[model samples]
Target chain A: MIASVGNVLVWMVWVGAATACLASGIAVVTLTNPFFSALGLIGNLSSLAVLYLLASAEFVAAAQVLVYAGAVMVMFLFVIAYLGGRADAPWAGGSKLFRIAAVVTGGALLAETLVALLWKSSRLSHSAAVGPTFGSPAEIGRSFLTDHLLAFEVTSIVLLVAAIGGVVLGIQPSPEEETTA
Target chain B: MSALFLAATTEPWWISLIKAAIIINIVLVTFAYLTLAERKIMGRMQLRYGPNRAGPFGLLQPIADLVKLVRKESFFPAAAIDVLYIFSPFIAAFAALSTFSVIPWGPGWHIGGYYVTGYVANVPIALILIFAVGSIGIYGFIVGGWSSDSKYALLGSMRTCAQLVSYEVSLALSVLGVVIMSRSLSLVDIVDRQYHEWWYLPYAVPQFVGFVVFMLAGTAETARAPFDLPEAEQELVAGYHTEYGGMRFGLFTMAEYINLITLSGLAVTLFLGGWHIPGPWLQAYGPIWFLLKLGALIFVFIWMRATLPRLRYDQLMRFGWKVLLPVATLNAVITAIVVVAV
Candidate 1:
């Protein structure tokens, strides 16, 4: 009886969190104010973290908050705040042709997702029901270090290169720009 | 008798709720006293009396401050984002308090047939959850600043966002060393790992550099004195919450104290052997030992606040990214190598 109750409660929590997540995602696009949009993004990210928890992907959920909602979103807010009035700049700068192309590209991506969903219904519905040991940090660490070692190393290299590139590009100005100024 | 009844019931959800309430109340009361403690300690450090007038050595000072703040008028800017401006401080306080849910205060206690752990939630990623919730707190400052419609507030928020993001890197990397050593992410498991070792063999010995980096990054992350460039009184006037008044400002202050306590708690748990008393005699009183360790770490926090001067903006950024990050990364790499080899 207690086990059934616990399972029901978990499902209820999952439903509530997933709904909030979707609502926040909608708010992110619908909110005209850049700051509000960013706020919506935070809400979406956090609720998604809650959903991750419900799914028992505890480490991934925490990382979702730490890296995406926390650090990355803060940077987005920082830039929005720094730019101030410019954050609300109109999309008129983009040509009509460019806007049309963007819309078409978005629609194509949406259609592709829909087609994939319909084609792989059974596999998609499985929800990746992992075993008891699957989402544990130690398990993830072992798999990363051994089974996916190349991908892990490559990711680190990519991040390192990106960091160095950012530092180089940010610190020293181009000679042409310096001379022009 | 209550424990006996509870044991027979097998009602974890209700018991967890009760535990949550107890923990929250304890934390809130402690937060109130912490402000008083900081003032008194800081006053002594600076050679002055601090708030001695309010009910016997300022014991009632936090209460008095709360009353005053509650009675004061809440004023909002004319052209501000009203909803968000109103919402930010509550978010800050909420985020700060929620970080405690996963933090194990001591070993599990068995009363009658019921078993109870110190923490509300004992997820596998307890440490990372602390970091995750802590990161969300930056939004409170950002939203509060952006919505304030003041130049100083905007600038302060921008600085806070940058500083927090930069330091969070070092903070997370520093913890990687501890995670490598403990081989588990649960706070309780980490503490248990320290039980077999003597006092000095605390992860601090192997990850001394990480500890230092964690402390530095934590200080910066919390926006305490020395790393308090976000709300520098000399320049930003009150920083992000400059336009806030009354209970709103009080909430921000309350959140700051809670964050301070959380950091101190983390430091104690990760590096200071948590609730494990050194000698055999005191081993049974795990929760008491845990509180003592937490108090000592909090004192170090207050001591640093009283002594250290705020770092310059440029210097703060440079230290976080250029120095702390690399050092933490190196510490993690070395610890991983050694742990693997062993």
Candidate 2:
């Protein structure tokens, strides 16, 4: 069998990075200030990007960084600001409900990871049976255009409407009473 | 799956270490000089010599700046949230640094007959990860603003968050055309498809609207001019990092250049036939040729910064939602039709 050593290191880094991200993700909700929580989430995300890199997912890692780290958190920041939530934060302590939710979610994640680890080899490799390549750029592009064309069109229309809505919202002054005060 | 099954296998740690070192060095060196180049160009644009004394024609300026920043005292805002105030820059820097792992700087050429991937990450979804990192970067701006504990900083960072989130969809969707045309998420694969014919001019032509959206939003993404409302120095006295001095501030500064370089690299890879040296005559230039192409893309970024006036906050938001986003969608639709038919 034609074998190479790239596999072991990839798995090790991939698992290590995923662990770091999940650990930090837990810290996000645990952290005191919303700002710190946001920072923790960013830490969690970067680790995930690193994990993606380790998996030989070149495009996904870049997109992970660009869209999630670059764009999505921007939304979080905007939402945090528009709310004008309190900046003075006390040390964070979980409520009974959050702790329970965390435990349940944590259990689910562990179960999934266990399955993934055991079935790792089968799931890891992609076959080129469909064509000369699996997930080749050309094939993905054609599929996106042909098979998923309707969804693509719909996404565009939705974005267009959203853009118009944002403009309309921005132009309208906050209900006069708030502005006057 | 073939890529993943190899996990049971292992490579020499030294080779892996060398590759990791390469990734780190590229980001740091690129960020350092991007600042120097921006200054030199901006200086020339305004008809003045910039950093001439630093090193012959300011070649040594970025090196000097790096030393100065490292030696400078790191300070946190007194009234700020102590720990996060300190951590925001690293969060920013790390978010910025991770974007480079997937970039295909050149073809995995055989150096001494040893085939190399030429990238740190050779994954199935490289582009998605890039955008994801970009999203995380928003948290840095938000944290910096909130940690600064100042109204101006808060407002600035808040603006950044909003702008990036809104603009990113259009950016992603716009580039999806390239994804559709190229069918691969790996930037290397994208470039491979383009080597025969540049995707930008043929398939990506109609998708220029996305490019416009991407460029504008990406400009905002890095928190740079016109879209640079997050750190609107004139208004916020440096926005999110207003309270930061020394090394903390250096992180913010470095993050800006890194974002710029990363964006340009992505742009070149997706739309500009990354590392595909132009000219049938120039094919011999090889990877160095791609570096040259990257240089030109970087120059355009600095050029836009110098030429374009800063966008008003309201105008920035309005343009994104009203102008770029709609145009991007329209472009995507049109390109899909043309691409499918062809």
Candidate 3:
């Protein structure tokens, strides 16, 4: 009886987190004020981190909070604060063609998800059960050093390139460039 | 029935709740005295008496200050966002308290036929868990500043956002060296690894560069003096909390000290062999040793506040990104190489 109760509590918490995740995600896109939208994005990211923990991906959940919610969202909010928290123009005032394109894209996504759910998607089904080591940092470290070494190295290179690009774009003009201009 | 339920469960939930309440209350009382300690220490450093009037040797100062703050009227600027202006400081305090949950206060002990751990929760990724929660506290500064609708407050918050994000990289990298050496993400496991080592072999010895970087980055991360551009009194007039007053303002002040204590505790856990006294018999008194290391770190924090001058904003950014980050990364790489070679 106690074990069953514990299992029920887990599922309840998971459902609550999922609901919060979806609500905050909708708020992110729908909030008129950019600052509030950014806050909504943070809420969304944090709830997703909880979902990741529920899925037993503790390391990934930590990364989600550390990198995305903590760093990336702060930068986003910083930019928005400088710009002033102006509400976006109403959707009706936007270009008709742009609205149509957005609607079409959203509709397509909705249709794909519905079809997959209703038809019992084979690609989504997997027989193998996750083991004790699954999603653990040691498992990740092993894969990174062995099976996924090439991809890991490539990702680092990509990050390096991005850093360089950021520096090149953000730096002030040198004395020579200023003089020339 | 309750007995059967307790037998079936791995976690003794009631005991954990009791422990959490004990820890939280202790932290609250500590936060109160830390303010008194900071002022008294700063006063002594500058050759003057600090708050000696409130009871003998200023022992009652924190309680007196608490009462004074509670009695004062909370002034909300007309221009401020009513909701966030009030909510921000709560978030600040909440973040600090939440991070305390994962901290292992000491090894487990048996009492009344039941075993009890020192901490509330001993999660697998306790180290990163603290960082994740600590990062959310940044929102408090940002929201507090931005919601105030004052130019100085806005500028202060923006400075805080930039400064914290910059130093966070070095802070993360510095601890990466320790995590690499321990081969574990749990703080308890890290402490266990250091138990058998000699006195001279703290993780800080091998990763001295990382230690230096950690201290520098940590100063910036916590917005301590020298990196406290966010509330630079000379320039921005108390910065983010300029518009805050009464108990609301007190919360932010309390939150800073709370962060100070938590960070010092973490530094002890990561570097000073966490709660481990040398001899076998003395080992049972782990909590005392933990407090000793934690107190020493707090004293250093206060000492630095008294000794150092605030850095220029641009210079602060330069140090974090250009100096600290590269050095920390190099230290991590070297540590990794040695770990692999051995």
DockQ for every model, please: 0.47, 0.36, 0.41
For A1-181, candidate 3 gives per-residue lDDT tens digits of 8668866876787899999999999998887888888999999999998878767678898889988999899999999999877435533546889889999999999999999877876756643466767677889889999999999999999999999999899999989999999
Interface RMSD of 1: 7.7
Clashing pairs in 1: none
The best candidate by DockQ is 1
Tens digits of per-residue lDDT for model 3, B90-144: 9999998888877776888999999887667766778888889888999998999
Each candidate: chain B TM-score = 0.94, 0.90, 0.95
Best by lDDT: 3
Clashes of 1: 0
Kindly report which residue stretches of model 2 are placed more than 4 angstroms away from their true locations once superposed: A1-77, A81-181, B1-16, B197-207, B278-284
Calculate the i-RMS of every candidate, to one decimal place. 7.7, 4.8, 6.7
Please give the CA lDDT of all the candidate structures.
Answer: 0.83, 0.71, 0.85
Instruction: Find the 10 residues in a row with the least total lDDT in model 2 chain B.
Output: B1-10
Q: Runs in model 3 with CA error above 4 Å? A: A87-94, A121-128, B1-10, B197-200
What's the CA error at residue B106 for candidate 3, in Å? 1.6
